[model samples]
Target: MFHAIPYILSLIAAICAALPVLLLEPSRTQSAGEIRLVHLLVTWNPAITAILLALGLVLAARSFFRLENRAARAALLIPVAVLGLGTYAARVNVFEKMFAPLPDPGFVAAHQADFLSPHDLVLGVSLGDESKAYPVGIVAYHHIVNDRLSDEPFVVTY
Candidate 1:
């Protein structure tokens, strides 16, 4: 039972790292309960994951000394790698990485926009003499578009 500490900690750390990302990913359909869980995990993840990884590292180090066989020591590598990956996942904002912002937005004249059907949704913005229409389909994946209109910088989000 005592020897299982590292594996247990690694398993839990992996779950902690993956739970929020899985529930909150943009493409997935999220329910209220799942969103609530993601909120809870986001609040507690850093502290909890740090503690688990630290404890697991210390325990694995101690196990290396107690275990004499070469293969058993090598087996500890799996848990160490798991803990490392979990820590990385917990630290990074994978959603932002996956859904990149539209850096250079293209525009077409309304009359020339043959791609848009009559009923398609769009976000229309007007600044002074400038007018632009962003299709909802494009905005949904990128989430944000940064552009300049009438020489003033602004952002659009969906």
Candidate 2:
């Protein structure tokens, strides 16, 4: 029925907006299929969300002008709100906000790094005569480190 089109479109748009967050934001295990789905969704979410929002808005407006029941008109508006939310979600990369890159990382000699145990894993970078070690524990959280060694710039990612 014509009345159901907006509801279906809204539901799909909401899922497209939420699927990436649900799969990525948590520190839980994901199956291979789920990970693949997340990658596909993240890659195409912007286009898919934009098209759905546009279509849903146009259809909802048409239905709103024709519908007689106030309740039905109000229900049709829910799709607009959901599509707006989808647009926002598509624009923002929550993971980037959560795990920002370390821009001004400090370094210390291995002997002075008492926080690291003898067996702690590290990501080591060597540039000419200069060298630095980044603990994997820290790199795992921030995911990227921007540093300079002897006036040369490099980035390390985990």
Candidate 3:
């Protein structure tokens, strides 16, 4: 019961948001239409709630002014801004967790998109002029089999 409070609150909010579309919107009051509205409402309700909450909290916190008005305002503004940004950024983290199966920006940004296999070899040479030999399979796996970081045009093993 205690741990379920947040989940319960979220469910309630989702239902409340869908209620208008499911009930008041006469066209969408049908079964399939209601289902679509419920899906949209549930998906979007949490985000809306979070944004409103962050804005409200920031406003409330910033309203607590004091003697050094300018300094106090600046201090309040800085934290509120950070908090608001962080609240929104947390959603990005959530999305990463949800859809990590696909290659996301973070994976490409890290430059670890190339997954190497034992059978693969690398047959590489010097960067510009000086020549050198490398394992063909290993380098091929690194370049051909693995996904590009969305920037590099090409990578040749030999």
Please list the C-alpha lDDT of all candidates, in the order they appear. 0.87, 0.88, 0.44
Using TM-score as the measure, the top candidate is: 2
Write model 1 residue lDDT over 125-153, tens digit each, in one string: 89999888989988988999988899989
RMSD of each: 4.1, 4.0, 14.7
What's the lDDT for candidate 1?
0.87
Ranking by lDDT: 2, 1, 3
> Which 10 consecutive residues of model 3 have the lowest summed lDDT?
101-110
Candidate 1 residue pairs in clash (backbone atoms < 3 Å): none
How far is 120's C-alpha from truth in model 2 (Å)?
A: 12
Ranking by TM-score: 2, 1, 3
Residue 99, model 2, lDDT: 78
Candidate 3 local lDDT, 1-158, one digit each (tens): 33223334334444445453445444443677767765665567557657644554545453553224666545454444444543444344332353333222122211342554556454533444444333464443333332232343334432
What is the alpha-carbon lDDT of model 2 when measured against the actual structure? 0.88
Which structure is stronger by TM-score: 1 or 3?
Answer: 1
Model 3, C-alpha of 23: deviation from truth (Å)? 41
Model 1: residues >4 Å from true position, as ranges? 24-29, 103-122, 127-140, 146-155
Error of 3 at 147 (Å): 15
